[model samples]
Target: MSMANLSFLNVLKLDNNQFTGQIPLDLRRLDRIKEFSVTNNRLTGQVPALKKGSVSVDSYAGNLGLCGYPLPLCEGSTKKARTGVIIGAALGSAAIVALVVGGGMMFVMRKVVRKKKEDPDENKWARSIKGTKKIKEG
Candidate 1:
């Protein structure tokens, strides 16, 4: 059911074919496969790991259902794993937003405090009435 038995075959190029189904799990046995390509096919499932430099992600492009390693992990593959990733991302985003908002609030509060310190009467509730009373009496 796989191409593993083809011992003498050193290179296999099956790009742009309408091939479907998972990659041969026994593909790792092809020790002499110096170059391989299976791009632009309708294949699915995790690609079998071959020797380094024997195949690259370019060899497996155009297959949407493929996942792992060279491509991102598939959604819903592991509920716990996916949930952990989501939680981590949410916490990271919340931390950034909190930092920005807290920093802004601190900046605004510091400005208000500094302004109040610069002119104490500017914020007093009775300063205007006191000024009016002084003017009337004068």
Candidate 2:
């Protein structure tokens, strides 16, 4: 039988069990619940909000996939987290691209500068010779 049908239940403890799947949201309908515990279970999915102080972190312990208030916010907690990750990855990629292009340009410029320094007058002499016409040796 479902626990939600037990509307008159005041205290429910199902700790240290092999229960799997989500804790039913209908459990919140048990208005008479004064104490609830589902710790040490294989429960997954967000834990439903029950009585104000009836549930705590300890009540949902050992369930790694469970989340929501009274525990950490559920994974992906809407699109904000996913969007942030996407934006972060995009910015990281852009930075990498910028670094690669900048490094390539710097390397090319350095090579040109070194070549000029090594043969400062090589091109100058060639240009001067081209400008002068050869005289006949008769």
Candidate 3:
């Protein structure tokens, strides 16, 4: 990423990777970053003060060697992290439900497709739809 041409990055989705060291200082310069994340990695050091609602605690986990505000000043980082986990879990559960419902809907549509393929009457009607004769009134 050339520092010369990254002025409009609204979302920095760097989750679930192996990036080490502290959060890059240069990132603070990007005011357009609304969804910054560096979760499930080995990143250490203080958590940066992200623009409110722009970043969440979920974006700073799986690393057993990091602390600071948002992660919970120092004394309560562990407790706060637990809460974040519960929240993440709830969100995760909702996502799973959505996927299941979507999958079921797709499955039902596939069955409908198969039934249509099995029914010759439906096929013939659909095939002749554009060729049907228009009746004239006397």
Candidate 4:
């Protein structure tokens, strides 16, 4: 039953009920309502404004579709924005990793070329043998 027509209601506790849709707008006209709650329901849209500091915010918990003061502002594109940020970060990390790896490979290739130029006549095995012979003779 809609509680908006109840004129003399002082305290209303409709928690844990399967009430769907929005709280009736006419409820704001109730002057004597001191405490009200509709928690754990499928209610959606802006909650009907009540007297300031009259009811605790906890009384409105578990209604996922509700949005207003004390609850976060409703946002439909939040998931999409979050996904875009994650994809951008992943692409950025991949680019940085690729550049670092390519630079390292270039450095290693340059060192190999320098080593080859310094010893054109001797292969790697021959250089090691020659160095060992020199050490033994000394």
Candidate 5:
């Protein structure tokens, strides 16, 4: 069987192939591409910066010679966990804040309801007396 030639705009998967060379800089020129990968190829070069930005690290995986953004550095693989922790922390904080604010709002609402229940007639009379308090006080 022969490999069929196909035109791809958003994806160009050639994973686990024997293709060798620097990944083309022009690969970044595919502006509409949101995901691009050449994992498990013999590609060699400084890694390409996405001109369009923000593809997943799995997009660069399993290649021997590719380096930068998503690769293990002298420091080691950090990006994946860092992103997950950041997103998790942010969501956790937001949940806490929502609970606090919602509780506070419920507390305020409960107070108003209790006050109304305690003195339903006071509200009506209080309104009447507001504009005439000085007159009544005199």
Candidate 6:
């Protein structure tokens, strides 16, 4: 019952089905496939490189896992995507840390400035007693 056994099939449309797993390589043997499609299926892995121009790019639509020609390149074929994600996460974390530290520094600085302003005579009493000497009582 393999699809290869149907060598005479000229048009095969298996779209919008619940089919899973890779598209059988045997289907490539169908030299007479003039119109083919497996869109909106759960098919995974690369689509067989059947006769060029025999299948449209839309034929693989909705198959997120399917790749190769007529579809997006597979995950292995692109490293920038993962690298970009990692870099983006790192930058986001760094930004958050900087904001927290900056906020803390600003709070502390404001408190110190406010204390100085509120106590303009702060240490004036200590300065007045700086030259005072302790006297022994008879």
Deviation in Å, model 5, residue 35 alpha carbon: 1.7
For candidate 6, lDDT tens digit of each residue in 11-117? 88998997999998777787777888998989998788776346878888888889978787777756877888999999999999999999999999999999888
lDDT of 2 at 19: 96
Query: Best TM-score goes to which candidate?
Result: 2
Per-residue lDDT of model 3, residues 32-111, tens digit only: 66777787889887776754345767777787667776676665667889999999999999999999999999999999
The C-alpha lDDT values of all candidates are 0.80, 0.85, 0.75, 0.79, 0.69, 0.84
Q: Over the stretch 34-125, how does candidate 4's per-residue lDDT look in tens digits?
A: 88888899888766666533866787888888875556755754777799999999999999999999999999999999887988765667
Better of 1 and 6 by lDDT: 6
lDDT of 2: 0.85
Which window of ten consecutive residues has the lowest lDDT sum in model 5? 1-10
Deviating ranges (above 4 Å) for candidate 6: 77-138
lDDT of 1 by residue, 1-138 (tens): 558988767888888997999888688788778888888999988777776455767878888878755667656668878799999999999999999999999999999999888777775666556556443654
Model 2 lDDT, residue 32, Cα: 87
Clashes by residue pair, model 3 = none
TM-score for all models, in order of appearance: 0.50, 0.54, 0.46, 0.47, 0.41, 0.51
Clashing pairs in 6: none
Clashes of each: 0, 0, 0, 0, 0, 0
Candidate 2's error at 70, in angstroms? 0.4
Give the least accurate 10-residue stretch of model 3, judged by summed lDDT: 47-56
Ranking of predictions according to TM-score: 2, 6, 1, 4, 3, 5
lDDT score of residue 91 within candidate 1: 100
Q: What's every prediction's RMSD, in angstroms? A: 11.5, 10.1, 17.9, 13.4, 11.6, 11.8
lDDT of model 5, residue 46? 58
Better model by lDDT, 3 or 5? 3
How far off is residue 9 in model 6, in Å? 0.4
- Error (Å) of candidate 4 at residue 53 is 6.2
- What is candidate 5's TM-score against the reference? 0.41
